[model samples]
Target: MTAPRATKTRTPKIRENLPAPQTAEGLFFHYTPEEAAQWTPFSARTLRDRIAAREIEYVFNGRDNYLTGAQILSLNERYTVKPFSKTHTRVAA
Candidate 1:
């Protein structure tokens, strides 16, 4: 009897919307879910969940939702932990 061949499973490619080149200085661009995922460790679905739960702020440009770089940075900052300082000594009661 012939051995059955194993089929290869492929992951679907995520389509991302690239931001346009800045026409003026100091102007920022918005990112799609896929693009935002590239900047953060969370997946696109997580981002969407965050948006739905109002955990993160987002902008709706008439038809589509977008996130700004500042917003992503703010989200990251919210989860960042500050290191504990070990300079002070405990006082005896």
Candidate 2:
């Protein structure tokens, strides 16, 4: 009689549907003073001063400061200059 052939057992594969990881562009609506300075025309020191003087809104997370998108929008509204009118010219009296 021939020896019985050994059978190999295979484990079933498991698949999971996990959420995609957040990227800097997607997750970072808030920014540090330094980061905000880099993204905008303001200097880091200027941002810090604004935070200190309460001219701008910020979040203090025990260790670091952060600025939100809404704050940035408000700042832009406050500081952004409108374009000069091309139709209106100064007439010498």
Candidate 3:
């Protein structure tokens, strides 16, 4: 007798639009790359690239990846550069 082969299967999910989860600050939800592109200057492709590169934190919900608002804000802060003061000048020895 031959052994049975294993296979993978996918199930469909159906649900109505729901609001984001509530927190001490306010409502918060994980955004897909497509949605994240709307609030960010980067495109969905760029965000996905970042996700693949592990440049930013993300949640892998079984099938898809998601980013929280906090993660986006953290990424912004991480890459932000401080401007040099005009009063500062280089001294020549």
Give the alpha-carbon lDDT of every model: 0.70, 0.64, 0.69
lDDT value for model 3: 0.69
Residue range 4-92, candidate 3, lDDT tens digits: 87686643332335333334231357777776665566788899898999987888999998877667666667767879878978899
Between 1 and 3, whose lDDT is larger? 1
lDDT of 3 at 66: 82
Model 3 C-alpha RMSD to native: 8.3
Q: Give the per-residue lDDT of model 2 (tens digit) for 15-51.
A: 2332111343423366666656644458877998988
Model 1 Cα displacement at 17 (Å)?
Answer: 9.8
Best by lDDT: 1
RMSD for each of the candidates: 6.8, 17.9, 8.3
Q: Best candidate per TM-score, number?
A: 1
TM for every model, in the order presented, reads: 0.62, 0.54, 0.59
- 1-93 per-residue lDDT for model 1 (tens digits): 998887887554555455432323202567776677776768888998888788888888898777877776776678788899889888999
lDDT for model 1:
0.70
- How high a TM-score does candidate 1 get? 0.62
After superposition, candidate 2 runs with Cα above 4 Å error: 1-28, 84-93
Clashing pairs in 1: none
